[model samples]
Structure formats: C-alpha cells, structure tokens
Target: MPLLQRWRQAISKMSSASPSRFAVLVFTSIIFLWSLLLTLPISSADGTPTRYLDALFTAVSTICVTGLSTVDMSTHWSPFGNVVIFLGIEVGAIGVLTLASILGSVVTRKLGLRQRLIAASDGNALRLHRGAVSESQAVRLGEIGGMLATVALSLIIIETIIALFILPVFWASDLVTHWWDAVSYSFYYSASAFTNTGFAPNPGGVPEFADNGWFLGCLAAATFLGSLGFPVLFSLVRWARDRSKRPGVHVKLTLAATLVLFVLGALTLWLLESGNSDTFGSRTPIEGLLGGSFLSVMARSGGFSTIDIDAMNDSSLLVLDALMFVGGGSASTAGGIKVTTLAVLFLAAVAEARGSSDLQLFRRRIPHDVLRLAIAVALWGAMVVGVSSILVMSLSGAGMREAIFDTISAFATVGLSTGLTESTTPAAQLVLAVTMWLGRVGTVTMAAAVASSERKQLYRLPEERIIVG
Candidate 1:
C-alpha cells in the first residue's frame, strides 16, 4: 500500500478523537512524510542526501506555509525537490482538515462523521473556546461538496491567471534563462504569492522583480487576494453572481482592517525609510513608493521583499513587527492573530472607552463570544512570542531585538528575517521550528485540543466585578 494510505489507516484509528487532534496528527504526518522524501539524494542538486534535521525543518516550514528555511531553495534543491516543496505548499495552503475532506470526497464521494466534523470546524472557522458546533451546523453533504469545489476551483483559476500574466515578464527579464524555467518560475511564484507562502525559487527573489511593474503588480494582486481568506473570496464571488448576496461580518471587518493596515504600513515605511539610503532612499520616487507599498502588503504575512530587511530603521522594524503580528484574515493562508481579530479587539477597546454596551463595527453589533475569542487568541499569541523570544535569547545569545524579531517572524509564519536565521544554533532553530508549527496550526486549535473534556455548564455562576485596567 502507498505511504499515504498507511497514514490514512492510522488516522482512521483515531477517528473517535477530537477534530483538533486529528488535524494535528494529519499535519504531523505530512511533515514527517515530506521530510523523508526530501532526504533522498534525488531531492537535492548535488546528488547528496539532505540532512534529516534540515529536511525536517524545511518540510515543516513548507507544509506550514511558513517560508522560513534552513536551506537556500534555489541552489540546494533540484527541480524534483522544488516540485515536492510546491506540492507540500499546496496541501498546506488548502489546510489539514480541508485536505482530508478533499481526499475523502474523491475516494468515497461521501463523508463520514469525522470528516464532517473536521470540515465544519475548519470551514466556519469555529472557535473552540466557544465550543464546537451542533451536528446540524457541521457541513452537510451538499455544502461540503460545494465549499471544497469552490475553494479548489478558485485557487486553480487565480493561480492560472496570475501565472499567465507573469510568464511574459519572466520571459522578458534576466530571471529566467530558459522557456521551461520561465514557465516553472511563473507557476511556482504565482501559487506561492496567492498562498501567501512567499517562497520564490529565483535566487534574487522579489528584488529581481523590483522594477518590473507587471510582475510586481501581478504578485501584489495575487497576495492581496490570497490573504483575503477563502470565506471572503467565496462571499465576493457569490455577491458578484447575485446582487442580493451580502458579505459576512468577518469578511467586512477583514477587508476594512486589511485596507487600513496596508495603507498605514506603506505610509509609515515610506516616511521612515525613504531617507535611509540602505532602504528606499537610493531608489527612484516611483520605485520607492511602489516598494514601500509592496513592503506594506508583505508585512501582513507575505514575506517577499525588495529591500534589505536587516538594514531598516528601528521604527520601521517595530511597525513591521506589529503588522506581521496582526497578519491576514482568519482561515487564510497567512498567519498571526488575524486582521478581524485585531480589528475586533481594537473596536472592543474603543467601545469600552466610550462606555458603550455593545461593540458595534460597521453598524453591526459584534458578539461577546467573538470578542472573547479575539482576546484569547491575542493573549495566547503574545505569550507564545514572549516565551519563544526568551528561549532564543538564552539558547542562541541573540539580543532582545534579534530574538523578538526572529521569534515573531517564526510565530507569525512571516518568513522575513533579520540577519539572524542563518547563524542561529540548532537549539534556536528548533525553537523557531516549533514556533512555526504552532503559529500555523494556530493557538485556537491548540486550545481546543487541550481544553478539558468536562461537560458544559447548564447555567452560569453569579457575576462578580473585577478590577479595571
């Protein structure tokens, strides 16, 4: 039997377990399988076997849609390895529960209870803190089929369109020496950008396309669309098809926060670095503006860069760190606390400051449950970053700035690094690897898996006032 089938058999045995556990298992299995595949001599350019630890880290990063890598992808990996990495990214981007649903659909054309639970939890972005949904809320046969179909088709259509648009640029530039290389690079980068993975096979990466207007345009568009989240994308498609269809609260909040953050980040970067020769100062006016906008787009989870990340001013780095921590929309390829969460958290605070009873956003009254979720996710993420930073500091002897930046990058799954990732020791690297996994898997899911199995209360206890902040 195939290796995947064997894993399937094992996972089936755990069918009775929580969907969160199942999800963690599936992702863990993929990392292990891919790492083993990457260990083969054929996977590397030099015809030598890739080290197990390096291969494992690469597998985790790729599968997590985190672009952090111990290996220089262009020089170290052969075409075969690149293809393997691409496949891993694709699967990872689709997500663990969703991927299982896809496979189950292909094989059985029907889903079991386990598949239904996983699909619903992932599809609706269920917050386990609020507890799982009812059986009826779990995706039905028809809805699951439609959701998976729409997601797959949307990804294919978007990637194809972006790839076609970029192919000519690759053909025109010094980036591609051969027709096949152009084709491959076009497809890979298109998928990578759309998935928010930001793993460019090109050695020079985004810098090579810095002045290429068409390439940058396509890339930015792809990244924006991808980071918008599948729910928002699907809702937009529905609205496009039928005027009566309206976007959900999540979609509205995500788009608004994303737009605001994008402009804010762009303006901040331009103001801070436009005079710094190491960053935007040396570039032309148009290049600097465009480059700053690109950096803004990338700050919210996409890791592509046109300038030296290490050379940025302290203020710019702080701004970027803040942006990266906020990340993209929930259920998107991008990581961090998610834009909606941040937006809601901010709105909640504003409402409290105004002494308003309800947290209203865009005239919609947000739920207390969702506000609690936002608070929990943010606090948990901060704690993870804090602990990871201290660990990196103690293990690798990195200063506060380097430790915080590296830890945040890993935790956000935003691969932009300072000059630190390469020189970090194995313990530091391991810390980062774990941080990447947790960030991608998410604190919400981890919370769900670990939350006690005690029964829900029939009634709440009497409320008591707490101290103010």
Candidate 2:
C-alpha cells in the first residue's frame, strides 16, 4: 500500500510538472497493462499464453492505433483479446489526456483549470510547454470541455453509424454465416475503421470484402473522417449548423491538404499499379480506382489494405512511403509528422520562392514560431524514420525498400507493410514498436517531455546570416 501510494504521488508530481511526460507515462502504462492482459491464456484463441514479445507488440500497435502486427491478428487472439484491443484503440484514438479529462469530468462533475490544460496539451503540444503559444491555431482553453464532449460523442455516433451501414453489407455477404458473428464483426470493423487502426477481426482480413465496395467505402469514409482530427470535426459541425461561419486557417489547411494528398496519392497509385498484374492489372477500371483510392486513404494512417503490398512496384512503394510519412492531421488518431506539418513546409518553400516575408495561409499570418515548430517536427520525425530504418535493415537483413517501408509504416503509425513485419527478427519488431509509440506520441510532445526545461533567453545574441546554396 505504501509503494502504491508512492507511485501515485510520483505520477501526480510528474503530471503537475510536465503534462507531456505524464501523457507519455499514461500511454506507456496503458501499453504495459494491455500487454500483460494479452499475455494471459484467455487472451489467446487456443487458451495458451501468447509470447510476451508478441503481446507487447500488439499492445503497442493497438494503443498507438498502428495496425502492424507480428502475429496473425485474426486467428491468434480470442474474443476477449479482441475486446481488449477494441477498448485499447478507443482509449488510444482519443488522446490519452483527453480520455483522462473525460473521466475526471465524470467523477468530479466539472472540468477544472488543470484538467482543461492537460486536455488542451493533448490537442496541441504547444500547451505542454511553459511559454505562450505563438498563434491561436489550437482550440481555446474554454473550448476544451466542448472538444472533450465532441471527442466522446463523435466517436460513439460515428462508429455506430458506420457499424449500422456495414451490418447490412455483412448480412448480404457469406463472410459470416452466423448473425451474432456478423453483428460483432460489424461493430469491430466500425471501431477499427473509425479509429484508423485497420485491424480486421475476420480471418481473411480486408480482402474478404474486396469485391464489396460498400463495405470498403464505409471503412474508407470512416478512416478519412477519423484522420480529420477533433478540432476540424468541431469546426465542421459548427459550420454545418451556421453556413455563414467558415472554418479557421488550421481547418482549411488540414482539409485542403488532406483532400489534395488523397487525390494525388490515388491517381499516383492508379497510374503506377494499373499495369502490375499482381495489383490492379486484372481489375476493372472502377475497381482499380477504388483499390487505389482505398490504399491511398489507408496510407493516411488507416492501415487497412485490400491487396497485397508486396506485389506493388518499387515506384508505388516509394509513393506510399511519402504518403505514410506525411500522414493525417494534428491531434488526430492518425499519426506521422501530420498533414499540417507537410502543408507548412510546402507553404514555406513556396513563400521563399515567391520572396515573401510572411507565412500566410487562408488570409492569415502564421507566426514564425509555427514554422519553426513544423520544421522541428519534420526533422525529428525524419531522424526517427532514418535511424529506425537503418536499425531494422541491419537487424532483419531486409532490403532497403522493405525495411524503409515497414519502418515508415511503423513510424507514421500507418500500419501498411510490404510483408516485412512478420518475417523480421524479434529485435527489429521491438524497434518498430518503439517507432509506433513515438509516432503516436507527437514529436513535439516527446521533445518537450524529454527536455529538462524550456529555456528562456534574457539577452539577445548578435546574429549573422550564413551562406547556403
């Protein structure tokens, strides 16, 4: 009892001192707990205990919302294990601090300043630091309660609607002979899709529904919506009710970039794989288009793949690498450097080309700090991918393409793989698991969490411009 009290006091100190670190601690604790649960005999389909390594991998993948698995997901786990995964992903898809805040509200009957701060930090990493936020891009503190409600309500409503749409399709298909199985699988699919985890409960995985475009469409739609983050969803709901109000710059940029990437990725995949007999060559034009589009959406952190990824060309693999690395929006279930980060970088490049001094987007001036943050996030993400790719390559004796693809998939939390996940060494799998954890935990948040303190300079140093090509 004393030891438990000490642990609680330590956690409370950490939470009060650094919200980001507390979030990391909370997520890590959850992963460990889930890992222990999964290692139990009941968690396995055969009523035998699962390997600790495999259980740990699944726990990381599940909590990270990254679907890459070292084990056969459909056959290895029992109904109880699947339920554990479903619950884990829901806790994970909604930010850790946000979930805590929701529970705290339920227990206490109101959100205090600390709860709001922690929840806001979950939504925006800038809030984790002790300094002023550069811009008003993050949801305001007053709005955190509403945002928390939206997170819970949207997840339930959206997944329910998606499950309803998918239930009829499952009934019409011969995939599940039993109505009870269909009903269970319907909700499973909805949760998986809406959370962007892409873990199919059935044996065959997504290919079982390949010819069923409606089912695939429902999953794809849910995946896309899940990628759009809670802030955008809240703004979208408001805009829906009042047509006069437009979304903020962040929303506009996220939506526009997400749409553009989707279209571009879909077209690129369609063009590249159209002639590959293993992928899209035999399919009808519409079917190929659907396949391309679905894969593209999956690349944005969805993790579901209808077709075999190993059969695609190197060009297509590279395209997927880029898409996965860019990933979904900020504060979303989807991971990676985020679409907004990519947008900022591209906009910065364009501004430099046009000889502009300000980083302007949607008629708003983005502060220099936002660009700095974006650059830091991109560089940090690149470093993680690069180092992990090298490690995976060295440890697994895998080719550059396979190692890089799987590493990026893990790092971006996208879960789309080129058949390297299962064949790799346990050590390599562990590395990828860490990559997934890091990816799901925002790069900025991790940086702040690890740093001793946010340094404040009292004096300005003389600056000089350096020559560059």
Please give each candidate's TM-score: 0.92, 0.94
Q: Would you list the C-alpha lDDT of every candidate in the order shown? A: 0.80, 0.86
The model with the greatest TM-score is: 2
Q: Candidate 1, residues 1-469: lDDT per residue as tens digits? A: 9987776666565644556766777788889999999999999999999998889989988998878888888789998999999998888888766765555444444576556556555645452334544333223334665556667887899999999999998888776778999999999998888888878898978887777778888988988888887767777776778777667676777889999999989888998998999999998877788888999988777788888898999899999899989888776788888888888888988998999989997667776766766777888899899999999999999998888887898888888889687678888999999999989886647434433243678999999999977
Backbone steric clashes in candidate 2, count: 0
TM-score of 1: 0.92
Candidate 1 stretches greater than 4 Å from native: 1-13, 103-109, 112-114, 127-142, 447-455, 458-462
The per-residue C-alpha lDDT of model 2 at residue 151 equals 88
RMSD of each: 3.2, 2.4
- What TM-score does prediction 2 earn? 0.94
| lDDT of each residue in 424-456, candidate 2, tens digit only | 999999999999988887574754453325688
